[model samples]
Target chain A: MDFRKKLAIEPGSTVSLADINPEQDGGIESKEEGKEKLSGILDEITPLQEMLYAEKKHALLIVLQGIDAAGKDGVCWHVIRAMNPQGTYVASFKQPTEVEKAHDFLWRVHQRVPAMGQVAVFNRSHYEDVLVARVHNLVSKQVWSKRYHEINNFEEFLTENGVTIVKFFLYISKDEQLERFEKRLEDKDRQWKISASDYAERDRWDEYIEAYEAMLSHCSTAHAPWYVIPANRKWFRNLAAADIIHRAMLDMQIESPRPTVDIDEIYRRYHHAVREA
Target chain B: MDFRKKLAIEPGSTVSLADINPEQDGGIESKEEGKEKLSGILDEITPLQEMLYAEKKHALLIVLQGIDAAGKDGVCWHVIRAMNPQGTYVASFKQPTEVEKAHDFLWRVHQRVPAMGQVAVFNRSHYEDVLVARVHNLVSKQVWSKRYHEINNFEEFLTENGVTIVKFFLYISKDEQLERFEKRLEDKDRQWKISASDYAERDRWDEYIEAYEAMLSHCSTAHAPWYVIPANRKWFRNLAAADIIHRAMLDMQIESPRPTVDIDEIYRRYHHAVREA
Candidate 1:
């Protein structure tokens, strides 16, 4: 079975955190072997991204959702850095400013969607409205509950245009998260990244998990699929993210545009220039 | 009476092109006097636009729709040119590409909406779907008929999110259209601008008026007002457009954002530096 198919949360299927394992790694054990496998996939990704850029007919949107410190930044750095800068852009949604709060939550997300033949990476996407907003009571229960249908319609609308969507929920165990935070605390350079607020958020672990389980079940549509990646092992996380993205790019059927003029006629003109050279 | 109210399309009122005189200049005559009045409006507009840009709270969308050579481009060049370039942008909607045709008509318009604290000018907007689409039988009557309600809802959505929308239908008499096309034929520099299709479109003038009348009646709302501007004379056209825009900006109550830092401390530090010098 395809790794993406294995990981993908089927549209309309009920989801539970217990069904997914944070420590699983596609049955791979050797860290060196995972690294070697990922390097090969990275090479193929560069050319496929170049073709997608040249064709300018389709767009790809990759959404990342997870609790704090679940390695969203790591996937962006290791997996998407191979593509040319002009072809891909990362739009990180942080705490909304007053101006953003004035509009609908989707207003900011809609603004950041990719144009033709571009790849847009959303580090944290509009899913926050359903997940974090629901858990924290940022909006009413009625508002958050209605968002599942709204998000489905929104993604369906984007796909009807030239956009293709892939979503990832990087799953990390609670104990592993505590271990990472402890490591950050010991390192002087990394202490600033780990704040008191993170542990405060970690206190309500079960509520967050419940929110994530609902988002996976409701937002995973036929057009926009969600893949749950095992994120306890950093090496496995990087490899799985790279493998699924490479496959999606291959499926795009992207090709260089055909010449508007006759190829032979262009060759004749080129031949004159080539002879001079 | 407020100039905006004088020109604004009254919400829920029925419209007829016969009720409007294309040559009426708001009872203003003497080109020199009109130019002077517009200059005063221009002076008020520049600073108001700067305040809007600085506040970063509101967005303004100006929609212009008319037949070919009804001065859509001219209004853009004359009235909009006074605003600072950093805060204003113009998007001209032409024939939809294959991807655009796949989505709802407002999809392209939604993509081009102004960011907070900026002004967006649509040369022709989603109204084309209701106007040109209706006249050309591009879709079934059922489809085009539904668009008025769709457009109303779209504009309402924008207004609910702090956007102020003002629409203009540039009215021109059929005899004046013939005169302009003749003028285009005579001038060598403008000869390329005249096209066979323009005449073909002009031949169905009454049909277009009917479409515009329907749009004015059905789509106009309190928040997104439509104004019919008499545009047969170029000077009057520029003055009316500028006057309405200036009034709308004034109504926005756009003010410069208050300083976040301590002004007194900064002033004290500046005084110390002056004393040391």
Candidate 2:
């Protein structure tokens, strides 16, 4: 499947995120059109969102991975904004807490997986041990390498047990990231978002890219294929994400379980209450 | 203000929620219509969201309070899901951790307040010390009573420094809650959501309502009016929340800041880059 073209994967297959410029060719798209398309798709998918909630036997898992300013949060906000609130949950994984560190890598994650008829989103997920931890030498190479198989097994388990997984990696060039960083620095309100860690991470961009490549090569199974989105243009990132979610939900075609009570009878009684009141 | 007459405010009164009987009043509104209205509002407010991000000077604090099964989390997912990610945040307050218990009442809260030009939502806020804690007798009445002034002062501090507080209390009848609880029990997927704590809390419904009323009377100020939402119907709950958020943002009249570079110049640079490529 030409993932690079469909997902807008970066041109320099080996380049670091800190080195790519926003001005780089093939790294961005028309913003207005992208946003318009995403909104249209979100509208079309509203019914499917309700259907998934009613069919509460299958769960969905969405994974987001991106560079510092690659619009992962924006993707989440736009793509799933119309979903049934009761049937959706989002969990953001951060640096391992003391509690998390004590357990197996997947322990905390397993607890947060969406139950039947729900959608669970992972902002940054279990892959961190192999990505960030590897880039920073936080864990030994042997240990990190072994985790790829563990992650694959875990995802396979989730699929077998009724969870559907959709994974995305936001790809933006180094130059574009630098420009966004500079913009954040210039805006006083956004200054707090800048951290020493971001700068340090930028310094190791190449290492992260290498780790990401290894992850994609090892874990991009048919059940959970990785989509590398070009994220220099925030609008395009959101559109691609919405489109992917819409397609996935439509494919599921979940039906509302048969109600024990006739819906028409329920409606008649409801109207009767309004009449009496 | 006739809260019951509020267009989006579900059944409209605390009295209504208290009287719900599922077998009798299977009240159903077009859920799709509420979803559409919320979507329309989001589209209308996109420019405002963009403007707020550019202005980045005003901070928003939304406070949610409700009876059990009153839909606070549902409200959060809809309203918060529509916001711009860069300038939005959420904090959910639960039973205090050991670290939290040692601090001043508002200490944990003070740490989570949003920065200028951002939105921060508190799910069950500092008022909990006065509401739930007081009702359960977890704290002395003397301590709880003093908290009203402290809360007023804390909010005033935030407002004077550019934060706008928006508080909502989800009101539902004892019967409606029982219906929801029953639904949870009957549905295997939702059974996990039911807990002994929920039942224990339900047993003191009247006491909690008294506490809520007292807290509302004392702390609902001109700066932050408590919006009592009838939440027996999910559609009404989502719409009521959207209306409040829309009104608050409108009151601020947030405008987008002028672009740093003219659009023509940006497009020209883009076109030039495209030609070179």
Candidate 3:
């Protein structure tokens, strides 16, 4: 199955978060099977990423957005880590600083977008403006409402300029979020990841769902679509995100540029150097 | 006199490079008068720059394009230096490196554009993709022609996002360029800047003028218009550029942002610290 087509939120279609199942596993029968598929997909991604770096014709931007403990960081560790670090960068957006708040919302985000031959992963991205900002009334409705249009224009501009953007909305049920929160508390190794605010935010789950639905419906453009990933099962999320990213890289069709110098002349010079040595 | 109005290439207008006098001095009678005016404008600009940095509402992007010895560097030294270096940056775009050539023409340029509350002066910029690229036949007509639209869209996008772009085509006569080149050879301090290509490029002066005229005509838009500064007289170039830049900043109307904290509460805390000390 082409996960890119299967998972993507259709452009211009309304999305109801309740209708989608978070536990859907893309037909993988078990966690071990999913992990095996993820590993294979990751192996395929390494060379494709190198070709992407060598070609330097296109940039890949992977945006991951979800509620607390929806595996945004997990996708980075398990899926994105497969790509070479030299050509890939991860930018995380949290609360805006004074300097960032002073400009238009996109100013800080634009600075972090990848250049050609690179992949940028946004752990929590500009979507937070709509998701978190909308849920908390951080800005007036008039302000945040117009941002949907601005974001579409910005994404369209990036796509036209050879950036391929794949946004993943890591979907999880409310119960799954509570379960993950409890797991974080139980695991001393994962205690740092737990925060009191994570539980507090659960109270606004419905509001957040409304915000996410609006974001998915409005900002999903043909050039840059949002993918709703079933992320209740961590292993399945990793496998699906890895598979989708691998597919996107393949679609770029990147190839090394034609040699600008005379290969024969360079080869002759190299032989002369070897003889002298 | 509004130098911005006098110097700007009207949007949607054709340009005749020969028709505009490169020796035009903006009606300033002597070097002393122009220098004095420039100095006054520079002084006024310092405070405005602080407010700009504090407000963080708008960014200033100044693009300088000119032939060799047309005083592109002179404008930066004499005018742009007036702004605080903390908030100002000078990015010089020379020959594209192998890595830069790998990406789209605008990729490197986009990365260097100013963020909010900052000023960026491009010593030589994306116009080279059109000017030098066209005059030297570095790219085909089809490739270079499409860039005019691309550049306009890029500039429009920047403007919509609160960047005020002021592009200056430092206009100079062929005789003036030759004179300046000779001066460069004569002055030991300036001898390093003298290049064989400078003389070679002069042979294509007419072609370059055609290329530049096309650029000015096509890419000049309402949001980011091109200013053809008469640069034969170096002092006048400095004066006209400084004056125009001052006018543009004034138009931005950047006031310091309202304090985000309570002044009374902060004062009380400050007093408490002082009392404890």
Of the candidates shown, which would achieve the greatest lDDT relative to the real structure?
3
Instruction: Report the error of model 3 at residue A213, Å.
Output: 54
A24-110: candidate 2 lDDT, tens digit per residue: 223324666556676788887776766676667788899988879877777767776667444565677889899999998999999
Residue lDDT tens for model 3, B1-277: 6888999999999999989999998887789998898899999998788778767889999999999989886776678757655466667798999999999999999998998988888988999999999988999999999999999999999999999999999999998987676565444444445555676698889999999999999988999999999999889999889988999999999875654443334334422322111
Which stretches of model 1 miss by more than 4 angstroms?
A1-277, B269-271, B274-277
CA error at residue A140 for candidate 1, angstroms: 44
- Candidate 2 on B42-125: residue-level lDDT in tens? 665555665675677787888888977888877776667677553565577889999999999899999988777677788888
Off by over 4 Å in 3: A1-277, B272-277
Per-prediction DockQ comes to: 0.01, 0.09, 0.01
TM-score of chain B of each: 0.95, 0.83, 0.96
- What TM-scores do the predictions have? 0.51, 0.59, 0.51
Worst 10 residues of 3 chain A by lDDT: A268-277
Give the per-residue lDDT digits (tens) of candidate 1, residues B40-130.
Answer: 8888898788778777789999999988889897787678866755466667798999999999899999998987888888889999998
